[model samples]
Target chain A: MPQIFRRGRFWIQLGVVVALMAFGGLLINNITVNLIRTGLGLDFGWLWRPAGFALAETALPYAPTDSYAWALVIGWMNSLKVILVGLLLATMLGVAAGAARSSRNRLLRSLSGGYVALIRQVPLLLQLLFWYFVAFLGLPDTPVGGLIHFSNQGIRLLGLNLSVEFCSVLTGLVVFTGASIAEIVRGGINAVSLGQWEAFRSLGLLEGVGLRRIVLPQALPAILPALTSQFLNLAKNSTLAIAVGYADLYAVSDTTITQTGRAIEGFLLLLLSFLLLNLLISGGMALMNGAVLGRLQRSR
Target chain B: MNRWLDRWLTLMLLALLGWAGWSCLHWLWRGADWTVVVTNLPLYAVGSYPEAERWRPLLCIVAVVVLIVITLLGTRHGEWRRSLPLLWSAMAPLGIWLLAGGLGLSPVGTQSWGGFSLTLLLTAGSGLLALPLGIVLALGRRSDLPVLRGGSTAYIELMRAIPLIAVLFFGQLLIPLFLPPGVEINRVLRAVVAFALFAAAYIAEDVRGGLQAIPPTQREAAAVLGLSPRQSLQLVVLPQALRVALPSLTNQAVGLLQNTSLMAILGLVELLGISRSLLANPAFIGRYLEVYIWLAAVYWLACTAMALLARHLEIQLDPVRSAR
Candidate 1:
């Protein structure tokens, strides 16, 4: 009976393998036929072709004469620029709001709670549009303290000319992601024992100092994992920059695909780029995790 | 010192809130023109469906609303609670049948499907498809077969690595190419497929977490009770795992509903899409603040409702509470 059961399992596994292979083959065959019919075979030769479309925002100097590959690289830099900055600002806002959730002050706790509840409910795209059309674009042409210039056209802060599109995308991402991060941070802080907070207070440490030194360090391990995923989410959400006409990687790929009519190639390149981006984020987080864990262990 | 600081912070917050509330009230009274939302109410609800046939989508939406209310209210009634899942599961097919039409009614093209109805359709359709696919992938990842495990892991990881918009974009572009020359799928179908594919990866991970939480004793007990492995899995394991996973799955469902708005960018007239078109109208131009505020309220209410429904189910499924 046992032998029969083993044979049955093997047969079932074999059947699954066969079925999957056959399905895969049929799809591949259809793709090949469709490609041939359309005269669009998969190839990467378009990478060297000059992308004639102009970008609204480029981190590195770029022109319409640049190769598609070069255009993509510039868009990537633009993506990196917004993502890194958004991550930093979001973390600051999130940590502040998250810590405030547990504050003794009723106003502070409810304010942060309201922020998280309200922001998390709305879609990010709507918020991005709100920021772009209603908030940033509605700004009057006035300079604040003669250092920051605000107008419907664009913002100029400390001699940095920021496009309305970039500002809106960055603001939307930070605000939206900050709410999520705040939740994670609150959960992390909550996971720490009441005894720890009491112990620190008994030691006569100040509330702020005790939180920074005693409570936060302990919450770091729990917070870091969720924080990494949120950072990755922000990276992924950065692709929504396209909605506001920001010349991010996905937007550039979209234009390249439309102009060159190389949907397959463009898609493959996008998948590869995003995979690389995800790896970079997770890899960096892993390193941080290691360093923090090491320090925590040694201190123990 | 702490008392002073707390008092200062409270005063500052109160002043800011008061000013903001006053400004909002002023704008609401004077500056805002809500005719954009008021006049386009039908368009926002059903989106360009033939005026006579608009009732189909409307009825579907009303049915869903009613069902949600009923489920929320009837959770404590044991017999009625058992049928709620069946009714909920029936919604997607019922929606498709009502909206797509065929046997007894005029078939509406997917192009005509838009507005909040379309958003609901997309969420329900993708969610219905993803749940089973995700469950299978989760089980496969933990299976004894090496080939199955590796394949499932690879697919889930690869899918999760990419952003959702790329998947949806390519689904619109590549799905047709992958199909036979004469075969075709509508854009709505394509979007649903893409969403399901993307969501399944995340769902699989959540389900896997739930599965890992189950103890080996349950399986051993099932076997001792003379149940076959398949029966044991279907009868004893999956239900408990899914119950454990209900909260995260609810989050995914809410996220899916919010994400259907991304279809607006791809040119489908879901909730946000309809608003975009409405805002672009010459008359409603520059009414972004009013339109966005309306959209935010709708989304917030919808999401809150979903969270509440899930909480109700969670309570219903709680073994300890049920035992009481």
Candidate 2:
């Protein structure tokens, strides 16, 4: 009987299950009592009420009279806007810097290396504040009569009309994410064996052609997983928009909670939306990975 | 053909660099305000904490640095290695006691803590707390027990899906609400809890990667030697797994350190928070640029130091690299 008790799966399972249940029960009991004492119950009815605040930036139409739910949607839209634009810019910057690091020109290599080292070493929050509060805001405001414009033409230069908050958040995300992506890109390039380059040289191909035709194809498979993580990171980092007074989902949620005292509902929307967004990104990337790998295999 | 293309690219890049240099020079000459940063240097360093209590944070820093040095020395000698965990664990409470101050020492409230020291404290505190919890979660995820496995997996996935900012918000807003009435957890403690819990998820995933890398034979060998599963895990499994996980672990530490800056939003006057406070000061109204530059430089220096230490550790840990 003792041996059976020691070795049996039944007892272990029962013990684990019971312990889990008891923990859950204790948590629920605490929350219930706490909620009762606060003169409030756990309900999301506050979300249906007016938000009564305007978003600083929104891709979708938003007004002060919108429901808190609509406010969250607008916040979500703004978050998505930053993520999409930031991802594009970060990828471009990453590729350029990553490629430049391996350039024949000593100046290009050192410049890119310095950028990666400096940018990656600082916290993203500080960089965001710098870009927004200092870099953008400190710019002498569009000199009364428009900074620069061609006569009767639509062209303009250094007008600086974009919101400082938005510019800061976007620049911060790009600079930070781009540094990481550059490292991944550099690693991916290095992982492509030197033999490929030699093969291109034997075929009398130019350096640019060799890199584009021979190196990048091989590097893509290696780069994709890391690149996907960076994309996810940028998406999440967009939440830093709150710090700069940008009305991203997190910022809006903070306002909602402050206004309505429904922390649970406010955070639940944030958690669910982010989870869905990440699932979509990962799922899309997985499909792309499969397609790329399948093509590589067929070519082989 | 290649030369022509290279020449055109280089020329364009040079022109771009020149324009950037000119703009920077112009800004430095006309825009920057130096006096604001100079006058508020003390405020940036320690917020508005009492001048008499200044030695507390300094003591915390000295104790932590000494503990780290001793730990490093112990590991290098391999003689005091077994006691290292005990010593390391003690350092956290010790550091806290020194900073928070209770017996004979003047008590400095959590609200009083701010600036670079607070940032470092949060990073170190959360990191130390999270490592062991992360290892357990990683093990639980890999365990045969369905409940433990399911629970850990759920936790890690849920945490990974959300941003750190949201988790912190919940820490500030929800955690207090869930606690029993009349029980007060200070804001700094709440932020620390949030950071540890948040970091545990990522650390678990990183550790899980290490655990997965271990071959079945090592565990089987431990079993054949009459070792219990717990013994096998504590002795044979964890050492090898952690060795493999060290680089990723260091990366997570650096990331967590950086994430501690988010504490500013929770109203902790850490590095970024202190900077914001400086910017908001009426006297320093337009000196945001100069202050931010200083803040970024400090972070850059600290982060670079940590990154370099990580590189050194990576080299030391790798048998092939260390031999050279």
Candidate 3:
């Protein structure tokens, strides 16, 4: 009976593998036939072609005459720039708002609660449009002390100039993702014991110091895992920069594919780039998590 | 000093709130024109579905609203409560039939399907398809067979790693290439397939989380009861696991609805897509604020309604609560 059961399992596994291969083969055969019919067989020589479309913003020097590969690299850098800055700003906003939710002040708690409720309910794309068309574009052209400038065209703070598209995408991503991260932070903090809060109070620790030194440290293990996922989500959501014409990685890829009509090759490149991005993010978080756990263990 | 600090913070917050409220009120009264939303109500709801046939999508929306009200209000009644799941399951088919319209009414081409109806169809259609596919993937990942486990894990991780717009874009561009030369799918169907494929990966993770929460003894107990493994899964394990997954699944459903707006970029005239074209028209050219605010409110309400319905289902499915 045991031998028969083992044989049945082996056969089932074999069947599944064979079926998958057959389905895959059929799809590939069709793709080859379609490619031949359309005369667009897969090729990467287009990457060397000049990309004629102008980018609204670039972190590195770029022009319409640049190679498609160069344009894509610039776009990837732009994505990385926004994502890193957005992650930092969002974490600050999220932690502040999340801590506010647990603050002793009733108004502060309700305000943060309201923020999360309002932000989470609306679609991020709509908010991005709002920030672009209504908020940033509606700004009056005003120069402040030769140090800062705000206008319908763009914004300048200190020595840095920012386009309306980039500003809107950043603001939208920060606000939308901040709301989710706030929820995660709040949940993580809540997991810390009521006793911990009381213990800190009894010791007469200042609210900021207690939260920073005591409560938050204990909450890190729980918060870090959820926070990692939220960070991944923010990275993914940054692609919506396309809707606002921010020239992020996906937007550039979209334009490239449209111009060259190389959908499969473009998609493959996009996929590989994203997989690398995801690995970089999750790997960084894993390191932080290990450090946090190590420190916590050492202290104990 | 601490008391003074608290009072100062309160005053500052209050002042900021007051200014924001005043500005919002001023915008509503004088700075905003809502005629953009008011004038295009039909277009927003049915998206230029033939003027004569607007009633089909309207009826479908009305049916859904009525069903929601009935389920919320009538779930206490025994027979009505028992039939609620059936009615909910029937909605997607009913919606498709009403909008597609071949049985007794004129059949409308998908090109004419747009607005809120298309949005609802995309969400419901993809969701209905994704749920079962997700369950199978989750089971496969948890399967003892090495090939099944590795394949399912690879698919889920790969799908999750890519951004959704990329998936939808390729779905529009490349779905044709994968099919036999003569066989083709419409844009709406392609979008649905892509959405389902993308969403199933996320849903499988949620279901896996729920599956892991179930105690091992439940399966052992089922075995002791002489139940086959299939029967044990179908009867004992899956029901409990799904119930445990209900809240997270609700989040996915809401996320799916919001993500449907991504379809607008691919040129399907769902709610946001219809609005995008309307905004492009010379007349409504600069009325982005009014249109966007209206869209935001519509999405918020729809998402809230979904959340409430899911909460109701969660309560209904609770063994302790239902026992009462």
Candidate 4:
């Protein structure tokens, strides 16, 4: 009888959970029905129309006359471009800043402290906007006009630089993402035990060698997870290019939604692009984490 | 050899700092015009805001400060030594002020505080709203009630799987449709709802981690105390569970602050939006480095303050549990 009561209670609890979930599903269903009624019933036909606008920066071959699908694909490429460039830039900046923060030199330590604090407190959007507006906008005109064009193609600065839009976007992404990376790097380095640092230093191993071998090896576990999220952050943040009118994936999708009034389709594409990119980021990072974990275990 | 290298590096860094400081001073002070930047930034902050509406933000700021003071009272120690939490609490507002118009002296309107400020508002609001929702969601997810668990699991996993911007875009599209026709919601509010829902899902995960951390012994002891399941969990389990999860929770809050900058895409006029607007000015061409430097300083300060405060709170809550 006691066994029966115990089994029955278990089933009863399970039943309640099932019922609640069903209610949640019902709510979602109602939301979907409401969406369909508002002239937004699902269809992919809008994607076939021409995008009529040209991107200032894209990695793929594209024209204003390209299909919305192709334009979106190009925009996705542009987002990837920023994410890739941003990742490299942030990683480099973070590593350097992290090392700088770890320095025994008090001046370098204070400088890094100020740098990290300044970057982390303000929003990245402000930083990007500031970069684009105040810094880019404040450029002095060279001789004849506003933008200097080079070799009959692409915007130039001081007649020497090429690809100003890409450069500007790249610069914004690097600095914005770099600040977070610096913190991550600092944390990872700090995670290395004090004993490990002393042991390495006592052996006449230089600061760089101690950091590279004894500290960083131990620090990787701490750093990897932070870096993973930062990578995810970098990917999501790429969408901010829309504000600067930089024509990244999200920006192009916004333009498409405005032009075609296909908000549903436009958003779907934007979502899927980000979803896939993030999957790649998360998946890659997880794999990297697994590798690191295996190595950590082996070392143990 | 090491000492020589150190000396050379110091001299090089000093030289770099000297050049940077000198050039920045020249540019702001003499090169083009400080008058233009000084005027433009203020115009964005307080320009279109009605004088009375101005009190709203000030009130909000006071409320935030009050909350911080109250939360600080919840702690038993100085916030500065706690590192991450202190970094976040102090710096987030300071950064916001710098981005939002520096204590309202150089006031920028809500419309002008684009980029980071917009992101911060949206993210901060969402995070606050999500906390309760996350508790409910987590309770549902772990409920003895089968349907509730299923619902929470579906909601959480789906949200976790979807990128946040998609959630933002969907909210943008669907919010107006749900509203009575001609009664429009602001873009920022819509963004907040999206962010809240997304944050709830993540918070659920965080809550779940806390939930799992509670030992079976604690629950058994609660039952021995003759408490109901809810009472037992709330009083005994949760305190310990949440204490364990404090660091991750603080980390999430920090990330949310940084992520709030994403609102620049929606044209919601936060800090980033202000910077971009200023950057596009015909007069301030090629000042990307200058704006970025200023804005970066503001962000770092805000993030640092928050991190420090949270770290302080975590320590106060449980000295034995300190991880850092």
Candidate 5:
């Protein structure tokens, strides 16, 4: 009888269910009382009203007279812009640095190692502040005719327009996250066995060819998962755009809250937007991962 | 030997170096001033903490250093390991009293606690608080009860999905609304709570990985020894799990330490905030480069030290490595 009382799934389930229900009711009651006392109800209807604040660099055509919902959407677009650009730049820099860390060239290897150590050790927010307040802001107020031009074909193809806010945020995110991705890349590369490199050398392949053809393909398995997480991290870290007064989602939400006094709504929107953005990134990456695995399986 | 290719690479590297050298020289000549940074070193270190009470923070720093040294040394012996938790908890209150001063010392408000000391305090406080809370949450997520598992999973996922900046904003803005009228929380405490909650999610995930690594047979063995599920978990499972989780947990802790800089957004003048405020001063108008360089160097040193300490602990905790 004692054994039955202790081990019975039915009794245990019933107890847990009842306890959870009671706890949930208590939490709801407390929240309701708090809301009533504060004279703020849970209606999101206030989002339809005017935002009344202008964003500095918005992807969409936004005015001070736009609805709060549109303003939030503009914030979302701005965040997306930064994340997309930041991810591309960070990956490029990370891959280059990661390669440099293992290069035969002594100076390149040491420089990359030093960079990874220094950047990764410092806080990202601090680094962002450095890029903004120091590097970008310190640039002599946009040379005589605003945008400086380097008309070389390569420079033209790269399309480097140094807008202060965009450049600062991009540079900061790239440097900070690039350092992390470099470590991941290095780890991924190192994870490939030495025997494979030996096999490539035996086939009379150059070092570069060996890495590109043999090592990196195997390294992709280790790299992809870390790279995917870094993408999510980059998207989330874009929220630090607030610190530099950049018009990203969190910055726009801050403005919306200050202008409209709708903290709950604005914050909820901010949370949901980031959550959804990350979910999309994670989902897309998972699909890519599946495809990669399928290809590898077929080859096997 | 690939002489021709090597020669081309060397020439290209030389050109790159020459360009970099020229740029460095130009920046030093035209873009930087160190006078402002030299003058404001004290202000950056302790912020506006009163001159008379400066020694209080210094003392707190000394105490913290002593505690850390003791804890590191304590790990070598088994008996000391058992008392380490109690020692840490005791140090928390003692350190708080020494810094804040209510027991035979002067009272220094959290506002006065800024700069590097405050940065360290926030990191240590949040890291310590988050570890146990995260363990509980991880265990709850792995619990057999559907409701408990679901609730824990939701909390962890929600926290993970959102940015720390958003979490800080929630703490700064929404938490006040939830609190009853005439009750208040300090800005420092709010920032700490936000950091702790944010870090707990990551810690929970790390711990879950550790928990999953533990074999099911361990639990079965504990059960055969007449242990209840809870007892088996506490005695048989958690110790091994925590050992496995230590490296990842340390990584999370180091990450949390670096992240405490975000509290600057909440208007708490930690190390980074002081640097920002220094740049805003009229006297330091164009010296952003100098100020930032100094701040980065300090932050880098501290973070590197923590990373090294974590590595040391990782080695010590592993029986194979320790035996070597």
Candidate 6:
């Protein structure tokens, strides 16, 4: 009787785990079916159907009656545009400001301090609104005597022109995220050790040279993890584009949900896509960090 | 002349600030006076809120104030005491004040409250609700029972893996489908719950870290005194675990508050939503910069204060190791 009870209790624990997972799956399935009939929808078939709506700004030229796939494709491209630009701009600003924060220059230090304090404090949504309403949407539309006509979707700053939606989203994300990156950069730089600084000074190396050569090389590991984490944040922050009417992955996903009532599938795709994107980011950063570390190891 | 130059620069800055102020004033109500600005805020916000329910939000505010004072004083003694009851005094009034209508202010139900105030309330509400939820989730995740541990790991992770937006979407458009008919949940409340769950998962992980740090000897010591596992956890383990967890938890709370702006996407009239709405307005079509800057500045002020408070807590939390 005692053995039977113990065996039963063991099964109960396993049963409980199985039950929880089942409930979770049930909840997911129920919602998906309620949103869109189960087993009725298939991928790319919907892609073939006409989107029948003109997207405000698309990287690809698409008409109202374009394939739903094409619309999603266009949205995907538009999102990539922001992601690529946001990545570049944030890295540049973050690295530069972060480096400056560690600089001996008092003015530079204060400027970095002020930038971080102001940017890190506010929510990204507010920043996006500021960009959309105040910056992008509010820009003087004159376009230098009609040299080019730019609206909410695209822009013509001078003889050269490009995507305004991309620019706006990038600007918001970069400014917001760069503040975080700056701190990471500063921390990495500091982790290089004061002894290294003293040694470099004794060797008659200038501050700039020492930083570029000795400091940055040692600081790579310290910065990479934080930097990767911030990238995760950027990927998430990119979703705020729904406010400004920019069609990044989330925006596209949202539109698809509203149109097709496929909330689970749409968000599932978003989750997978972002997971892939973040993985790519971490993978690439990891490689770069390894290469840097390898070189350091070899140098020793 | 340096003095004069300083004066001129100050004047110039003030002029620029004044212009920003004017543009916001103009955008809010193109040349409208103070009375107009004040009146317009309600027209823009809490329009659907019942005037008879004005006392709710105010009462909430009063309750929050009293709760905070007591909790702050309560914490002067130890870091991990059963301050949960003490915390309610803080939360109840804030919740009541936010729902206020009978207190001579318009009682804007959650749906009616839009814009920045809505955003702040949603964040605060989620943080308030999530604390205990997070503690339970955290403790459960660390349970000796395999069932509890596995279930918890799944819930914490599933919620964490999905972007916050997905959670919000599920809460808003999807949850009602599974419920029995006529038992609809409010979307904003859903958002608060969702946000709370999301934040709690992260907090639980943080708390678990604190839980792990404590020596097994401490728990064993408590057991020797004939304490139950639960008692040992509550009386002996939790107090020390929480002392270390407070700063991180507070930091997380501040982060959740900022993240509440995402609720704007779900059509809540939080700060960001109001800013978005103003953008579509013809008069304020191009005045987004001034408005958003002002709004960002306000958020910055609040977050900066929280960051300082967190830093102070971190310093204070360092174990008071007395040297003889």
Clashing pairs in 2: none
Q: Per-residue CA lDDT of candidate 6, range A1-300, in tens? A: 011123355676778778877887877666556546445353545657777767877767889888767777787787777777788889899988998887765556776888888887788877777776557765665655767766664687666566666667888999999999998999899888799999998998877788888888888878887788788778777877887777776777777778876665666677777667767777988888788778889988
Worst 10 residues of 5 chain A by lDDT: A149-158
> Which pairs clash in model 5?
none
Model 4 agreement with the true structure over A1-300: per-residue lDDT tens digits:
011123456777667667857876865675566666665666788788778988877677889888999988888888887788788888999888887898987778888887876666666666666666555655554445745543323346565544545556777778867878888889888877799989988999998888887888788888998798788877877776766677788778778888877776666666566668878988998998999899889988
DockQ, prediction 5: 0.47
In candidate 5, what are the lDDT values of residues A1-300, reduced to their tens digit?
012124676677788778978877765666677778768777788788887887887777989898888988998888888899899999999988887777777777887998898888888988888887766665553333434532211111234643567777888999989998999999999999989989988998887788887888888788989999899899989989888888888888888788776777777777788788988999988998888888878877
For residues B1-324, could you state the per-residue lDDT of candidate 3 as single tens digits?
Answer: 777888999999999999999999999999898888999999999897999999999999999989999987775678987888898999999999999999998999999999999999999999999999999999888887889889999999999999998999999999999999889899999999999999999999999989999998888888789987778888999999999999999999999999999988888999999989999999888998889989999999999999999998898789999799
What does the lDDT read for residue A109 in candidate 1?
95
- On residues A184-299, what C-alpha lDDT tens digit does candidate 3 reach at each position? 88998999999999999899998878999999999889989989988999999899999888999999999999999999999999999999999999999999999999999999
Tell me the TM-score of model 2. 0.90
Q: List chain A TM-scores, every candidate, in order.
A: 0.96, 0.88, 0.96, 0.82, 0.87, 0.84
Q: What is the clash count of model 2?
A: 0
**Arrange candidates by TM-score, highest first: which order?**
3, 1, 2, 5, 6, 4
Weakest lDDT window of 10 consecutive positions for candidate 1 chain A:
A1-10
Better of 3 and 6 by TM-score: 3
TM-score of chain A of 2: 0.88
Error of 6 at A132 (Å): 1.9
What is the CAPRI rating of model 6's predicted complex?
Answer: acceptable
Clash counts for all predictions: 0, 0, 0, 95, 0, 34
